[model samples]
Target: MITDRLSLGLQLLRIIVAFMVGGYAINECTQGFSSEKWPTVKGKVTSSTIKEVFTRSGTSHHEADIHYQYVVDGKTFKADRIIFGGANFRSPKELIEKFKADKPVEVHYKPGEPSVACLETGVNFTVLIPLVAFGGILAFMAFADMSKSMQPNSSIGPRPASNSSGLAQPKMQQVKGIILFTGLVAAIFGFKYGINAIHFGAIPGNAIAIVVLVGGGFLFVTFISLLPAAAGMLARARRFDLAEKVAKLNTKIASTMSAHSYETAVAYGLQAEIAQEQMKYPQALELSKKALNVLACRPKVDLAVNKFDDSTNRMIKESTIRYEKHYNDTESLCNESYGSILFDMGMYGDALTHAEKAKRLAQDNLRNAAAPDQAGTKRALAGALALRGKIELAIGSPENAKSDLQESIRLRKEIPHQFEEYLAASMADLASAYCVQSEFRMAERTIEEGLKIVEGSNKPSHRLAKAKLRAQLADVKMGMGQLSNAESLLMESLDVREELLPAGHPEIAKTYLSMAKLRDLQGKQRDAIGYRRSAGEMLTNCFGPQYQAV
Candidate 1:
């Protein structure tokens, strides 16, 4: 096939280029610094000239030419070598003054070869190091290819099949590309360091060395970080084996949270959402509880309240109001988060209870406060409303869900700077509610708007959100009896999810389910069955065999 031919061509090109570059570098190194035993003699300048040359690009440069005669082995020798490895440059006037007619200067010449002589003798820093480093990299690639070719077919074992409970394996091609790019960057830095080291006397050697060392250190850390991901792809181990990896990632996240106290509660709340997706209900609950506790214990000190007059008890009143407002806002957020997790776990009643409490707290804070946090209050209220909408939809109340979602979307748009991901999610939920009512056109429009909002965001999370919106749009299309459009959208959504997410992720499974439905609508029973089986396997891995969806 074409792929095999392309691979073979690339391998051959690498081998050929590596050998050619390596040979040239070796030749230059050997010729430049083979032996430093050249003899030096006094030479008299015979002639000197300098000229300015301009190219068609309108760039002008200067060059100096000088001729000298030296007595080597009792024979007069005429030479014009200014440097051993490369040409040297000087101003026209400087060259003329330095190399005055009959002026004596020192010259270094090879003992056995009088004709091969130089005014100076040493290695060339500008040429040797970069070529050698580049050549070495190419040579290594060539050697590696040869080694791979010689290895037995059995030595290269088959990759493990992806299982439901296992993390998705990254493509080997992607991994290799990352590694190669990183190696090239490291090699470039090495070549620069080599150049700098050769000119140690002319540059700040210590500073350059420190910079190179720090750069190399960062590259090493980056490579080490990618190792676990690459290894996961190779092993395709079950979820049970991922505990340590998850812990390490969580530790890093915790460290980041420690530096941003304002985000701690929300961070934990988000983690709880992820736990729910992994089918760990108890863990999700525990995480949400921790988020609530964190918010409760968090201190809120308004400097403005403290700066007010203390004699008239104004400071005390303001402090109390500020504290109450802050407390209510935080509580509302925590409650909304808890409700959302409960909703995911299919506890509609419990979720609705928390959602209502959140909504009430937010509204009360808005009504009673002298100067409420309008942004915070709106966000809390919107979240609560969205949660309630989701719970209502789950309990088969499409009208109530539609009303709440509309209100939530209205509140979100009122904010000057809204969170894109949340807005997209709320829009998707609203579209889903519309779909339940068989309002396919409205659902399609809502989801398309959500997709547009998310498409402008460059964040990885936004990409996943966009994929979900696309899938929801596909659902609307399917409901409207547009099978071709639905199939195209579903395939697009699947591609995005696969590129952005690990194998067997819940979103990927959902995309597969949608694809199965599309295939069934198209009367492709065999393809539909295959897609359904794939979705079921993924769901079983993520949510366990007893998962209702499975």
Candidate 2:
């Protein structure tokens, strides 16, 4: 079956090459006619000489190298074009014979552009033929490659292909050819118009239009090429595991240029998060490092915002602000990912450092982001605070943990977000912190509120979070010496966990451990021992014989 990754790569590449090179050639050829309306001036040939030009085949030929000077509005200018591009590659002996030093000529120069002058004004077929021929061949090759990648390898459903972002790959491939064909006319004519704005004068190639178009073209080609490359890397590593695929993707993306750094950082941050979810702390940390490194390569948000006060380009300034916010959001996610990973690894101090970084970045993002991004930005800040609070709780700083988690909960309540389950999780954390302080009533109250949030959501993850909250509530009851109530809560939590989690999940084993403890307190020794054995077996099955539920 044809993989979507290969198809996507070819698709993006075809669009870029078809648009840029084909457009460049078509535009360069067509724009020579614009010089016909240029005003004429009395000019003199300043220099005319023959230069020996060597070919790759070890042969030699001679061509005319000519220059002329003219005056426009009392300013003297020099030029070399006989036509717009001056592509008559005939004998230099003939050109020298026709025009010599101090020879009089009529120079056609653009009215506003004194330097853009030509002795002759008309289309140059010598330049047009080769460009059209070469461009056509490349465009044909691009389409052919696209066609090849879209073919099916099997008669079954579309081949399973997905990117790290989980976009609809097969569907995109089905219509990518149509997209390219429809875009061809627009890209060609737009390139023709955009490129023709370049007026080469005595200075040669000094035009903002040239810089913008060339830079845009280069980015469209090289930077977008990385997407298909990424798809290929992910597809090749499918057999190995997500970690391998993520590693390969990140290694390539991390080496990209500054213009791509924000995207690279965002990709790495997501990879780090996935690694953490898989319980791969070392891989998570490595991916987090890559995210941070790329983020460091991006433009500094503070400096760009500081320049806003003095800038006249309101559109540019707005775009710059948006760019700054994107970086801020990406960097915040990177730091938050690292903080979560380090916290899971029990490196509380190190986790706190990254949590702080994330909090600050999210705060900055909140201040400058566009209206649509406000709620999402607040969620990021809440996430950072929640992570830092968890780390604080782990390190015996209950007061700090309580404060951070409360503010995090407050932020979550302040905005209606899609991550309402996360708000529940933060509440559970706050309850745990309260439990750590021996405030049993406060802990019970917090856990109950968290339960309400989780109970409203039917998502599997939310259900698992509810089970955890249930377990926490049981602990508060056990501390209060409500033995019957505590036992009832444990049994209920175990039911939910068994129904929701896989048999080998660590959470299941931990729930079994709680059941064993509750049984022991109820004076059922044999039942308690059986629960312990079940917990041990679950842990052993998941993480080998040496591992325990704790």
Candidate 3:
């Protein structure tokens, strides 16, 4: 009885929240200022005051700012309060400096609500709908509780079917549960749609209308037809929920196991190949061992033995045990996956070993080709070859690096889509080689050509390619003593790289390091130290703390 009451209470809470969100959205939609009423206007910041300040436990703090303005919507509406609150904002000193610079500011203000002024404007509906829907749900749940209260014997009853004893079972509990579940699913969709609408501009407008109508029709019919059955299910502890969870877990384990196997194999093989290139035998052997362990296991008793609740887990265990021999034989795939992981980690030798094994398997049909040659295989081959060249270059074998890079370029040209990105990548590698060899003119041309190929790609890699090319072009210009040109190109590349790559990614770290070196060369020790710190932070994030060189 208490459980039923609590469930009803939760439903009411949900309804109330939903209704509030919807109401807010509708109000905003209907009364949100028109362009005429909220004309765009320039404002000078008369004074900015920090109204409240608070420190969170750690390295973060929050504060609210009130800005007084002299202008509003082309009419002088003075003493307006514009609230600004954000966690981890730029330091107050930095903000004050920016303000003191007297930067031109653009703002929008509603006529009656001066506090509602905004600097940047973007439309979003996600915030409104969910809150309203929750409010509505809360109200409905409360009403349900009150209605139940009117009857003294209002406990959720048992489900109905004429059993051997010939008594009709009650199913009120099941009905309530189904209703609550349906409402939760609806709430989830509402929240998803709301978030996407606000953040991604993928407002669920027409699609949402269709869904609501269709879903409402379905629920109405189901509520009428399965009313008795739903009540029955809710009345008893349903096995369906636990079964579903176990089923999902089984799927996840299978998928993750496959992925883990593949990554392990690839990382292993890559280390082997790179080791062969660099003649690092010990490292290669270690990587191979890591790959082998991906499938290694020990026997143990079942931890969860509940047949009713954990049947799916037991089934997975039995199947895996039955296929242990087969899995052992197929462990090479895991090694290949591990090798790939190593390659991505900049472990060139290990990446090559895996690539070699994958190449052989793919050609011989020993491994499952994800799709056709058009899938990842083609790119993988090209990348492996290029990485091999890079490893050779790093180990002081310039000639070998050149040869491998050329082959990679040739392989990339044969592919259909994403060819531009591949070409840009190969060219970047080639330009690096040319730069190292002091072939400035050839390096410049290669970088330029690479940038041209990236033009139509429009992918993030395209931007990355452009950044790399510009960076290399700067190097060439610097070599030629065109300091200004070098500076310009390097700065542009730095800006693009900072935007695209994560702060701690190896690529970003390398870019920062380069900038730091350049600054040091220019006798800017302080700037160099700043860049060094940035590079170090990014590197630590991209790779583990133990990662030293790469």
Candidate 4:
């Protein structure tokens, strides 16, 4: 009998709290809308004071206590309420200053009841706290009841069926619904409170608002992070589709080529050259072969067989030479494209061989021509130089890498329309080369120039490059014995790298290693060890234990 009574009492309390919360919410909502249409009157603040109240735990909080008189319908009324549903504020200085004695302010009052007056119309802590608590309690109770019903042999009859994953599908749906609903409620209140805090210009209120906004933002990011990785897969699929399209076009153009149209062949050859420049080697190779086939199919008009003059023979020979040069240029670019792709794939030896071959072919072409293809020759030379520099650096040949990188930089500058991103990247690599040679000041200056070029760009590649340059700068600073500046730059680099790269990326591991070095320089032995351990673990996870040597 006592157990039954206790259960009954608990149920009664839950129902009462639920009703009270519902009624409070409804009243506040009605008053909020009603206030918009409420008549305004000039009111004088008769009295205003700061009141301090202590909680049961003896923590004191302050509130502004203001009494004002407003005349409505030719009769004066006194009211203490500042805003509908608002409780005592944590810091009431702003409110107190606003409601000084004899200060005239606008008062909003109900049409029939002049006693119902408010300075503002909004739901506040007075309503929000109870509403949230009671709502949460009700939801918990419902969830508990549902769980009890779902158990085996419960009086509530058969439970819902579960899916193949052994989880009740209905329950999963309910959980998702609850989470989404709670998030929506939090977002709405967070935004409303943030705007209100800003509107009132309350310092403490603004702090609370910031916390709410940040929490809401984190929740939003977490929600988005749960989405499927469809976008990345779709992008990869699209690139493959484009590559296939290029292959098909090349085949079609190859089969339809005629003997009389060398111009058409040259156009396709240029297209192939462009594809090679973009590092699409498979497409470039296919197009280059097709262009070569078209050139081979051109009519062989020999002057000896046709009994033509020496001038005509010379003209024919000149045209053939031009065609052969174009074909050789396309071939060289295709080799360079292969080299670039190999470089990106970390096949250093293969990349170096192809890069050298492309460089030699471009040089030979430039030497033989009366008027060289200046742009093509420069592009091929610069690309080969950059690739060779990177390969040398990877193989620990700092002097060779520095020489090639410097030459590449000079060549890139000589080009009329310079590729800024590539130039900045080469500068960053050159800075790293300088760092490898312990040329701290030169490394710092080189990276600083690169940063100036890329710092303002929002592209991910630019940002990633900038992060890498910052890490190199940090290393240079460390070499210079500027521990404090090195630490700061490393931290900034880590932030950008973490934002740009995926977790456990090699770049992130390198940044951690730099941070460890900085900590060691600063005499933080414990922190240095910890950072080094983190770097080792990240590198091991990303590239196996052998790569953790750094």
Off by over 4 Å in 4: 1-334, 344-346, 501-505, 520-550
- Per-residue alpha-carbon lDDT of model 1 for 149-268, expressed as tens digits? 333321012323442211122233345445664675565445433432231111123643664465445434433333333322222222323533543354355436463342455445
Deviation (Å) of 197 in candidate 2: 43
What lDDT does the true structure give each of the candidates?
0.65, 0.67, 0.51, 0.62
Summarize candidate 3's per-residue lDDT along 242-302 as a digit string, tens digits.
4233323332443354644432333343334333222233554565565465546423335
Q: Distance from true position, residue 378, model 1, in Å?
A: 0.6
Q: For residues 297-402, what per-residue lDDT tens digits would candidate 4 score against the true structure?
A: 6555443523667778777667665655555555455466556555543567877887787678767776775534565566667777887888899889989999
What TM-score does model 3 achieve against the real structure?
A: 0.40
Query: Sort by lDDT, best first: what order?
Result: 2, 1, 4, 3
Alpha carbon lDDT of residue 447, candidate 1?
86
Candidate number achieving the greatest lDDT relative to the actual structure: 2
TM-scores for all candidates: the values are 0.50, 0.50, 0.40, 0.43
- Judged by whole-model lDDT over C-alpha atoms, candidate 4 comes out at 0.62
Model 4 Cα shift for residue 176 (angstroms):
52
Give the deviation of candidate 1 from the true structure as CA RMSD: 19.4
Clashing pairs in model 4, backbone N/Cα/C closer than 3 A:
none
